[model samples]
Target chain A: MFHLLDIIGTIAFAMSGALTAMNKKLDLFGVFIIAFVTAVGGGTLRDVMIGRTPVGWMLDLEYVYVICFAFVLTLVFRKKFEKLRTSLFLFDTIGLGVFTLIGLEKGISVGLHPTICIALGTMTACFGGVIRDILCAEIPVIFRKEIYATICILGGIVFFLLKSFHLDNDILYLITSLVIISVRLMAVKFKWYLPTLEKN
Target chain B: MFHLLDIIGTIAFAMSGALTAMNKKLDLFGVFIIAFVTAVGGGTLRDVMIGRTPVGWMLDLEYVYVICFAFVLTLVFRKKFEKLRTSLFLFDTIGLGVFTLIGLEKGISVGLHPTICIALGTMTACFGGVIRDILCAEIPVIFRKEIYATICILGGIVFFLLKSFHLDNDILYLITSLVIISVRLMAVKFKWYLPTLEKN
Candidate 1:
């Protein structure tokens, strides 16, 4: 189940990156670079921060192949993607859920302090999008008082509780992912946002 | 002498960043951010890679003041900066020298392998501009060619040789910086470029 989420998340993230490249009028190679970064960048950072050598993508060549496939799909069927935005968002939210749970679980497994683990999980789940935006020359929505990071943090805390209760792995994963998705979706629908410093 | 060069180099890099931000019509905060990153991003990366905790700018608040002063000068004296393309290039070259030498020396100080030190120096000297370009939505010239990284590598090797011969730090640093600057200026003058790879 987690493996399926990984693949789904990779594709969704790649699409978002590809869309960003297209918006920026980048060439094929540029688009591919962005796509690859979006797909693996978060996990790669997490592994490096936690001192997990050999990195996730380096360990699994399948991630590379899948992202390549995503690139081809984006290149060959660019127009079709315009129609897929809504579904793509759904897929992306699912991927976010999966990424959040994976990050939380990895943090716990590494025996980090719970507070640090939650923060790490939030970073792992959301920073790739921030990086993508920074590279694409757009302000990262996450940094602008969005509830996006908040959702990831909440999901991480929920994961900690489920683990304390000794819930089954699959059950814990699903619950955590669902929470992230619901929070994010509701945040968007209801225009929930964190308060920001007043701009003069 | 090296201290003077360091200040001049940082000023040149910051000016370039400020000019780029101006060209992009960025806000004051954006310009400041670009200038700060251009001035000190290289050193920060060097510290991070070497596990030098509390990266350079974070440690010395002076770096912050320097960057802000540069930004303010650029903003206040916009007309003077507008006519300084060549002057800016000269400063950037000087910066290339100081940054490359300082980066290489710092790498070796941290006990990285000789080859790694050279690579780190190259990255430190050039990656700031690379990041600056990426943020401004341009293709980074460093990634596009060998000259940027290659020049740093050559200078780093020269530094190691000079040290092995027990050369004075000042003389060794001058020689390395001069070599890097000369190579970069010549590359720009001669329009040096490597062969491009076709799509895979």
Candidate 2:
């Protein structure tokens, strides 16, 4: 189930990146590069931080194939996909939840402090988009008023809180993912945002 | 001697990042974050790629202290430093040279191919500025027509070519660094640029 969710998330992230590249009028190589980075950059960062070499995407060629498929899909159906904003949002939210859980688990495996684990989870869920925005020469939406990373952090907190109750691992994962997805959807639906500081 | 140069390079990179942050009107915390990332982000990336755990900055707290000192220096003497553009450019160039050598050596230590080592060296010398530019919501100067990264690559090639002559390690280092700094200075003086793609 986790593996399936991960694949779905990867495709979604890749499509989002490809669409952004298209909007920026990037070359074909640039589009593929951006798509691949957006799909795997967060996990790659997490792995690198904790001393994992060759990174996840480097180990598995499937990620490359998936990103390529996503890029082609975006290129061929740009207009059709334009009307799928809600679906894209849904996939992105699911991706965020799954990524957070993966990061949190990796941190636990490494025996990092819980607070640090929460940070890792947030980074895993958000840094892909951060890298994507950076590559596109834009301030990351999460770094601004977006409620994205905040929701990941909250979900991480919930993960640990439930861990204290000794629930089954699969149950814990399900609950945490649900919390993240629900929070993200509600935030977008209600137009919730963190307040930005006024320019001085 | 390499240690001293490394410290100097760190300080220069930190100052460069701090200046960029100030230009963007970032808060004090943002200033420090940007400064720290610019000082160590390149090397940290290289280390991560080569499977070095915990990264250099994490192992040595001195980098943090230095970045903080640089940030304070920038914060206090903003106006005075405005007239020091020449000094800043010199420091930046020297930093680039030293960082390239350090990355090249690290890559060699890991037994990577010479070409990959050269790429790593270039990344080390330039990625800090790339990160800083991205954080500031601008395209990295190196990604455009700037002759920055090209100089590092050239220096790396020189390092290997000179190594074939069995030069002493220190001599090799000196020659490589000189090549990088000279190329950068000459490029800037000559207004050298790679041709950018025309807007489609």
Candidate 3:
């Protein structure tokens, strides 16, 4: 079940990356690179920081295939995909939730502190988009007061708090992911944002 | 001698990152984050690619101290440092040279392909600045047809060509680093650049 969610998230992120690359007029190589990075860059960073080498995508060629499929899909139906922005946003949010859980689980398995785990979760969920924006030569939405990383952080806190109740692992995962996706959707619906710093 | 060069390069990169962060009007935390990323980001990426985990800085605190020292130096004497742009550029070039060597050596030690090693060297020397630029919401100089990563790739090729003659290790290091530094300086002085893609 979690694996399915992971695949969905990866595809969503990859499509988003591919679309961004096309908008930037990047060549084929740049498009694929951006898509791959946007899908896995965050997890790669987390793995590297925690001493998990050869990373996930390196170990599993499935991600490569998925991202390539996403790239081609986006390229073929750019207009149709653009029109489905709402659906894409939903998938991206789901991806964010699952990614946060994966990161938090990895951190716990490694015996890191709770605070550090929350940070790792946030990094895992958001850094991929951060990397995509950076590669596209734009400020990351998370850093721009979009309330993205904040949602991941809050979801992480919820994960640990629920864990204290000794709930079933599946139940815990479901609840945490739901919270993240709901919060993200609400943030968008309400046009909620953190305050930006004033220009000096 | 190589250690000294590494320190010089780290400081140079840190200063460059800190300065960019300041220009972006990032707060102190953001400044430090950018400075640290700029100093170690390339090496960290290289290390992660080759399955070296916990990375170099995570293993040793010396880099942290050096980067911190660099940040404080840049912060306190911003004007003086700005006036020393030429000197700073020289240090940065030297840093690039040594960083390239370090990356190349690491790749070779891990028995990676020669082409991959050269690519790793270029990435190790340049990606920190790339990360800094991306974080600062600017296009990376390396990606912009600047004669930067090109020099590192050429230097890597030179290093291996010289190795065919079996020179002394210290001499090889010095010659390779000098070649890289000279090429970069000349590229800047001569306004040399790779041809950029024509906008569609």
Candidate 4:
């Protein structure tokens, strides 16, 4: 189930990246490159920082396969996907939750401090979008105004809080994912936003 | 001597990053972050890709100290450095050459292919600037025009060619650095540029 969710997250992020690149009028190679980075850049960063070499994607070609699939799917249905922004957003939120949990797990497995683990989770959930925005030549949207990383940090807090109770691993994962997804959904639905920092 | 060049390169890159951030009107924290990344971003990416654990800067606090020193120096002499563009460019080019050789050595140490090592060399020499440009919301200068990376690629080719002739390691390093530095200097003097790809 966890593996399945990871695949879903990768596909969603990849397609979102492809769509953004298309909007930027990037050529095919550029579009594909953007898509690939958006799906794996965050995890690659996390792995590198934690001393996990060969990175996750390099060890498993499934990521490459999925990103390629997402690229083709986005290109084929670009017009249709334009009107399906709501669905895309939903999938992206799912991605945010799953990726954060994955990062948290990796950090814990490495016996990292809770604070560092939270940071890793936040990076995993959000760095891909940060990278995508950077490549597209924009100030990262989250840095400007979004409740995005905040949600991941919150999820990490909840995951640790639940773990303290000695809850079943499955239940702990389920609750944390739900908390993240629901918080994100409500943040969007209610139009929650972080205030943009002023140029000083 | 190599270590000295690396420090010079780090200081130059950090100062350049600080100047760019200052131009963008970022606060002190943002300026420092930009400086830090500009100094170490290239090597960090290379180390991660090649599975170098803990990365170069993390293992050696000297990088952090130098970047901090550079940050303060840049802030204090911002106005004076504005007139030192020639010196800055010279140092940056030196950094490009030194960094490329360092990357090539690392790749070779890990027993990677010559082609992959060449790529690592170019990336280590250029990616810091790329990340800085991306953060500053501009298409990477190298990707858009400059013959910057091309010089590093040429240096890698020359290094391997000299290796085949059974040159001394020290002589090979000296010749390769000289080649990269001179070619970059001439490229700038000659106003050489890559043709920008057209939007299709």
How much is the lDDT of residue B8 in candidate 4?
A: 96
- CAPRI-style class, candidate 1: incorrect
Task: Estimate every model's Cα lDDT from 0 to 1.
Answer: 0.78, 0.85, 0.87, 0.88
Interface RMSD of 2: 4.8
Q: Which ten residues in a row have the lowest lDDT in candidate 4 chain A?
A: A24-33
Residue pairs clashing in model 1 are none
Error of 3 at A27 (Å): 20
Tens-digit per-residue lDDT, A72-187, candidate 3: 98888888975899989998998999999999998898777676687689889889988898888786656655678888889999999999999999999999999999999999
lDDT of 2 at B137: 90
Q: What digit string (tens of lDDT, one per residue) describes model 4 on residues A1-200?
A: 98898899999999988887777766565576678889999998899889887677755767888998998888778878758889898889889999999999999999999999999999998999898888889778888787999999999999999999999999999999999999999998999998867799
Q: Which ten residues in a row have the lowest lDDT in candidate 2 chain B?
A: B24-33
Error of 4 at B152 (Å): 12
Task: Locate the minimum summed-lDDT window of 10 residues in model 2 chain A.
Answer: A191-200
Pairs of residues at least 3 apart in sequence or in different chains that clash in candidate 3: none
Query: What is the DockQ for all candidates, taken in turn?
Result: 0.07, 0.18, 0.17, 0.18
Candidate 3 lDDT for residue B179: 97
lDDT comparison, 1 vs 3, better candidate: 3
Can you give the TM-score per candidate against the true fold?
A: 0.58, 0.62, 0.62, 0.62
